[model samples]
Target: MFDYQIKDNCLSNKNILITGAGDGIGRQAALTYAKLGATVILLGKTVKKLEAVYDEIMALGAPEPAIIPLDLKGATKQNYVDMAATIAEQVGQLDGALLNASMLGELNPFTQIHEQIWQDVMQVNVTSQFLLAQALIPTMLNAKNASLVFTSSGVGNKGRAFWGAYSISKFATEGMMQVIADEYDSSTLRCNAINPGATETKMRASAYPAEDKSKLASPEDIMPLYVYLMSDDSIGETGKTLKAQ
Candidate 1:
């Protein structure tokens, strides 16, 4: 679908929420969507980073963006519910979401993974996403067309050594996306997952410290797929895993 160019203003009047919007792929997606004409709700743990993004958006003369400073690792179900309620009351219906926040727990043998680290990874990458989606479904339903994009990993599809809880969490993410897609098959809301293979981001550097970063695609480079998946151009595309490289 990304082979064709997305026209300017494709996202005009759209309201999208992006988790991890403070940096990396999430940050780029927020900027890209705003440039294309969407009101982006930035959700992330760091206020300073989110503020930077907000300032950048403002400087770009894009649509005014909103900030929701949240830590997925500690966010409760009620917190997600309240977030949805807040969006409904303050921002109206949500048109899309990029569920991009994730944790890279210590990569080790499954048996060697620390219990707390495993739990933290699952909480941030899987449980919080599920809860967020559950809470936001109503807001999405209000839109004529809604899109939900989950960030997946290559290790999630095919198990790799030493990926530990991160891999397992991504697998769960893929399953959650599929479940939501199936459940919403009759509705206008669509759900899909994207695997951003070997990107040049902090996470990638942490995972592969010795590798050359110059060869990897920057966060901005893979945004066409992100833009397409969130736009109306991807209508009827759901329950599929896309690679952004």
Candidate 2:
């Protein structure tokens, strides 16, 4: 399905929310969705970066995007509920959501990790995603069909030494996707996780500082799967973990 050709307006009239929309794959997904005719909600911690994406979308003559600055680490369940209410009031209903915001607390031995670091990683990666999905599921169900995509890593599906809390959090992510997918298997709401292996981004640079950057694919290069999942092409596909290389 990733290799399939997508129509120009495959996502027309859709309202999609993308967390971490300021940079990397999240940014590229927001831009691509907007260009394909979806009204994207750019959610990230940096207002300036979100504004830049909003400007670029307008400049490209795509649908004007909305900006929502949110820091997942400090966001509470009530905050997520409020955000969901706001989306319902303004956007009517959400056709899709890309839970792309995450943090790499540190890559160290599990036995040597600190409590605060583990908590921070879990809050941003696992807890925040849970709360966000819990709030958005109702709105998503309102649409004729909806897609929920979670960002995963190679280490997420398998244990890797020194990955520590980040790896553990990703495992939780995969589990969450599976549970949700199973619950909605008989419904029009589909959920899946995408593993973007070795993408060229700041996170990758931090994780592998000595590696050659040219060998890695850019975030924009792995967007075919992103577009495929968000559009109607992957309607019956759920609970699957896909890789983008």
What is the RMSD, in Å, between candidate 2 and the native fold over all Cα?
A: 1.0
Report RMSD (Å) for each prediction in the order shown. Answer: 1.1, 1.0
Local distance difference test, per candidate?
0.93, 0.93
TM-score of each: 0.98, 0.98
Question: What would the TM-score be for candidate 1 when compared with the true structure?
Answer: 0.98
Give the Cα error of residue 143 in candidate 1, in Å.
0.2
Task: Give the runs in model 2 whose Cα sits over 4 Å from its true position.
Answer: none
| TM-score of candidate 2 versus the correct structure, residues matched by position | 0.98
Model 1 CA deviation exceeding 4 Å by range: 1-4
The sequence of per-residue lDDT tens digits that candidate 1 reaches over residues 112-229 is 9999999999999999999999999999999999999999999989889999899989999999999999999989999999998888888988999999998988998888899998
